[model samples]
Target chain A: MFAKRHVISMREFSREEIDSVLDLAESLEPYARGGGCDALSGKILALLFFEPSTRTRLSFETAMMRLGGKTLSLGPTEGSAMAKGESLADTIRVIGAYADALVIRHPKEGSARLASQFSPVPVLNAGDGAGHHPTQTLLDLYTIRKESRLEDLRIALVGDLKYGRTVHSLAYALALYGADITLVSPQTLEMPDRIKADLAGKGTMVRETHALEDVLGEVDVLYITRIQKERFPDPYEYQKVAKSYRIGAESLAGARDRLIIMHPLPRVDEIAPEVDETRHAVYFRQSFYGVPVRMALLKMLIGDRLE
Target chain B: MNDGEMKLRVTPIGNGTVIDHIPAGQALNVLKILGIDRTTQATISLLMNVSSRRSGRKDIVKVEDRELKEEEVNKISLIAPGATINIIRDRRVVDKYTVDMPDLIVGVLRCPNPSCISNTNEPINSRFIVKSKNPVILRCVYCEQAIAENIADYLI
Candidate 1:
């Protein structure tokens, strides 16, 4: 059961476990389309976002509510009991007794792992600095299947591959599914070495490029991510590489008409607003998949019975 | 010479090597990898989970007979670089030296990155560029993460 497990890295999920979630995702897609099912009745999800989150938190809360479940939210470290010098171990130890499962997001890289060590309930990683975000990757796999009708389609992951934990997780999963991926990011933001080797060894055709426009036409999915301006230690360094690449309305003209453009959302001009109206833009649907994917995850984890 | 739980128990071997000061729990893994554990006639005294005076806990494997191979010695130096080796004859220490890095490491060290092609499902022996021996750096052919040394719980 996911309730007893701790998700610190994407590697924690074996190929078989990912398939189980994918099967659940396929079965639960109808409920996402508003089908009749109370899969999460009598369950409670605990949200402990130690960092600020606009989309991730909302998606989990909505998923729980849609499943006829209740949630207890504790947002950001500044205002929470964590600011008062409470350790994550203590925080989760107390919260675990109340909530059946924990959806945790913290800035520390391995905060999710540390929380699960003490908590009696299962721990789900929302975002843990630049470490790993397994939940988002699951939704991404669902989105790719729903949008492209295949998992092995060519994808060009653009912008901030270094610090973008979402892309890191997604790339590993894509490699596992035998997808051809071209990583288009600045040299400084190139895909980490370990990730590149993993993909290439599995015979996934991967290339590193500084320009997204040069490789734009060859991809079935154009995954765009912001520069993660918030993660920079120096503001000027952030300013320099902030807008190195952008997937605007003009950029999509040359793309395959059926090509899907995805972002984890809350974009800062990396994707233009006009692009949202195009048939290619699937960020909203990308966001929507979060609910069912998470619901399917929660169901498989803590089960249908909400504690 | 005395076989104590924590001390490096040196046996009266006719001729052989004795590895001392290994961090507890690492000796068996090293011995297994070196094929010493599979010896049929050789008497093997493997003290494990033993407490260390320096490390708070450690282990020592004392072999009664049979000397380790030169390549095996080099591999240990390359992998378990911190371990000390002693060549003994007639129950007397003849030569003693710490394991040093080998010039060319074929399939010795496993890259710390799980996603590295070397660590994939395929039966591939990972080749290392071996950038820096001091602070070990290995560039993966498949991935960019040049794993730093000391990342492994046990090098062997």
Candidate 2:
């Protein structure tokens, strides 16, 4: 059912499909870690990053390499036709001709969805401007499934809930798995009303709070996101909230023994370095899981042709 | 006044279309959807808050020498879901039917989101998935932005 499909939004995925991807990722962990397979041997995966990204781009390349597939990249937009005012659709069309599937990260919201409509091959949205990053959500669910349990899981999504697409996608997917959600963010950066309404419509039990201390002891996973200064209209608001959202060693003192902290990283100190050595820090492992999760996604999307 | 006298308030069109049962206060919007401006060539009659047997009050539009296209009929459905179209030819009703609201409305309404791909110069027409018909809530296919209010303003 996944053949030649566009992975554009988490809303597009059913709970069963999400679990299936996570299950496939678990099975492919050995191949991802060991690094050799002929599953997608003859396929070509294209990487297009209109926005700068490290983990998403590399992990996709890593996933493709592990599956024994060749990968090509449109490295920097400055070096590509996009710098010369080539439209996203035009670029996607050109790239789609050369690859089996396309992994795109654009600063514009819905650009990935738009690219999918134009491209000949399947489009995997690495990240769009506060729109979606389904693979990240998938890998996140995978990490939570590995470290904790998804069934009746209590998760607190902290920091930048307003603009952080990671939490937005994760909240919906987590609800699908029947996890109760605690949204922890400053008033200005609280989760959007539309998303909360959507979750409520799905009958997901969600609690909203400004204090992380309120839910820390109860939640199985503490998901912290970087308060993106780039997304804020005013730098003062960013500065005010960024200073208040940090988590250090003392922050976890009241937390449960099995409480796992996850972040979609490029962290500018939302999570202090002191927390990294602790078993609670599953983010690095979370980042590593991006490989197998993406490998599963890539295989699911385009591997049928390889058969 | 009697029902026949009430119907005589708006003159009949010889060969055009009559839109009836529009929700009161939406006659201007229906006219806008039909692209009726001061420079419009077609002779038009608009009646707002007229008495209706089904609805308490309604609006009606009668256009002379002009028939609405399928696109216009669909746009009218967005603003006036209960409105019916009567095709007039030689002062007689040739065809009559209530406008059907399509599940997917394409290219007629613009997405309110400024950042939506449809709003950009992408060579793609805007598309919306009708989530609710009574209240006319539409979710943009490209950006998934749900537009619930003032939908007429977003009409392309």
Candidate 3:
């Protein structure tokens, strides 16, 4: 049913669509765990990464391979036609001819949507610079559902709310499920006013705080993100808030027993290593869920079976 | 009679459009938006710093033989929300309507984001949903990037 549909923004999805993807991801767990599936035997998935990524790129490739689909990848701008000054539209139009679908990760905001406009096939946004990442939102939803109840839970999204595209997408998606959201970030890195207004329009309960400790015990899910050093135009500002909201074992002492810690990884010092052993730690498992979730998306988008 | 009481009325156009009540100092932006500066044939008159009871200071533009489209009026509202659009026919004002802020705008203004897909070589037209009217906040439909000030810089 999702054939040829571009997944550029989580804002475009309804609650039912989010649920369907989560349900499909749950069903495809075994298949993602390496159980055989040839739903896309001859399909070719093209991956275009204009920015550095580890889990997102790897999971998408793994998802395609697990679905018996082949992949063609263009990694880093240095070696690609981009290095030769090829336009994003030209690259997308050219690659759209060779692949059945495209997954693009660009450093520029809205580049994925731009790519999708030129691409003939469905274009899934891996991550866009300070913009929406629909697939990551899907996997995060799947992870949230798996770890804790998705509806009516307190979710505190901590660190770099201004620039974290993942948190931006997640906040919008969580609003759909009527989740009470507490945004934790430095004063300089608060969530954008428009996003807060959007959440308010949706009747989503949103509160902002600078300290993770203030809301750690109250939230069911502590969604953590690194303070992206590259997003800052000023190095001094980055250094000022680099370690402002860290989560260690000491910080988790007052947290709920069922509190699930989730992070879109390549984490810096925002999360301590000691927090990794706690029962609250599910970030790695959350990362593992990305494969099945992406496989579900690919299947829904390109596979023969709609259900 | 004193110059103030002399009633200096702008000469009426036989058939054209008049944009009135534009915020003072923004007539140039209105001209740029309507492409009046580039139009070589049309007879255009621009009145700046005119007195107005409603806004105190206003600007006006009269374009001969040109009736503005709905989209053009909406674009004008982005820069001058309280401006009025007047259609003149046979030297008489036929229809006059205040420009209302549009909910959605298409292909009039370029997105401020340098990396926005609309800025790229893609054939996509930039689209925005008006979020606020007084200050004129435009949120890009594709990128969700909000532009609040200096919107004239992004006018297409």
Candidate 4:
């Protein structure tokens, strides 16, 4: 049962738990498509965004609304008490008193976990600074399963592997399903050693390379992430790797027809506009899946069905 | 004097504790962990960089009329994983045991990350999971940031 549980990391979920969530999401797909459900009628969710996130924030709010639950939103911290030097724990403690569950996004790593320690209700991580985003991972998993089979598929995660928290959490979730993962990134933005070690420890097949062309034909899924300019300590370093890996339509010539391309949105140039017309492009549909996936998550966390 | 005959000796305490086999140059860190400074009333003897047969060089701390608490011993293990704690009673070693590194450490050290919640105005204690013992790698339970060096500076 997921009642009162804090979803801080994808690593915290077992294969069975992930399956349960996916199953719940599948069952709630019709309900998310304008059907009615009062599973969370009296429940109130708190949305605390210390950072700017349009899609994630909107999806979570929409998810709660679809479930007949109301939301209390605290937008960007600039106008909030946090900018006035309020602590995350203090904010969570105060908000936790009012809501049935809390969804938090912060610019600092571990902010979600830190809030969870003081929150009386379940805390869902929207995104943390270069840290885990469990809900995003959950939605990504749902998309992958819907588009392609989950097990034993060759998946290539391309772009800024070092700073993309989405790739980090997704990699861990894919590892749970025994997916063969090829991490494609510039040398400067390669996956961290700790993550590689963890994948190896889990007996997950992992391959690292700088070029996407090498694994294009073999992959069943191409998960792309933007090479963020903000995560760099040196602007010069960011400029060097900015255009290193671009996936245009021409680049997908050798790729499998069944290959599903996905990206956590707000993409700049990492994914080409022409790729949007290709059959492989499922990233747009992927964004829509966030609603039902998050609705399932919220329901499981608050409703008596999963209890 | 011959190398074997040049043993440095400190007067034994009537009743207290002896922490031996500490890695060389960590005696001060041990004192910091024990909250021992110039203002302390207890009689304390610290021997640093002393030659030892077990290890090439070691540090030791002897405190009079004070036995280390279990929590204090755990903290010392973070800095000196190989240290041996010996309880002295009536000038005799009554109990002796080497420190065992704990799997989880809570509220003992500050997280080095300035952005960590533990560093904020929030009322939360720092928590770390011991990832390695030999080099003393501590991964913050919240942020998953690994702290490998300058651990003494983070001690609470």
What docking grade does candidate 4 earn?
medium
Tens-place lDDT per residue, model 2, B25-129, is: 999988877778899988888888888778989999898898887656867889898889999999999989998888998887889888787887787888999
How well is each residue in A131-198 modelled by candidate 1, as lDDT tens digits?
A: 67888898888898888955558998988887786897888888788888889987777887867776
**TM-score of B-chain for each predicted structure, in order:** 0.67, 0.85, 0.86, 0.86
Give residue B119's error in model 3 in angstroms: 4.2
> Which regions of candidate 3 deviate over 4 angstroms?
A1-4, A228-244, A304-307, B1-9, B92-95, B100-102, B114-125, B132-135
Q: What pairs collide in candidate 2?
A: none
lDDT of 4 by residue, B1-156 (tens): 245454435666889999999999999988887788999999998988888888989999999899887666867888888899999999899999999888888777888877666676667778899988877788998888889898878888
User: Lowest summed lDDT over 10 consecutive residues: which window, candidate 4 chain A?
Assistant: A1-10
**Candidate 4: what lDDT?**
0.86
TM-score of chain B of 1: 0.67
Model 1 interface CAPRI class: incorrect
Candidate 2 scores a chain A TM-score of 0.94
RMSD of each: 11.3, 2.7, 3.3, 2.7
Which digits, one per residue and each the tens of the lDDT, describe model 4 over residues A1-307? 4433878888789888889999999998888888758889988999998888889999998899999999999966788888888877888899999999999988777889988888998889988876788888888999999998898778999988887767877888898889999999888789989888888888886899987789999999999888878777889877777756788888889999899999998888888899999899999999989999999889887775435
Give Cα distance to truth, residue B33, candidate 3, Å: 0.5
What digit string (tens of lDDT, one per residue) describes model 3 on residues A1-307? 2433888888889888888888888998999997748988899999998888878889999999999989999966898888887888889999999998999988778888788778888889988876778888888899899999897889999888886767878998899999999999988789988778888989986998887788988989999988877877899888877756778888888999899999988787878999999999999999999999998888888774434
For each candidate, the alpha-carbon lDDT, in order, equals 0.73, 0.88, 0.85, 0.86
Q: For each candidate, what TM-score against the reference? A: 0.67, 0.91, 0.88, 0.92
> What would the per-residue lDDT of candidate 3 be over residues B81-135, giving only the tens digit for each residue?
8888889999899998998877888887898888676787656778899888877
For candidate 3, give the lDDT of residue B139: 93
Each model's total of backbone clashes: 14, 0, 0, 0
lDDT by residue (tens digit), candidate 2, A107-157: 877899899999998999988886788899999999999999999899999
**Candidate 3 residue-wise lDDT at A77:** 85
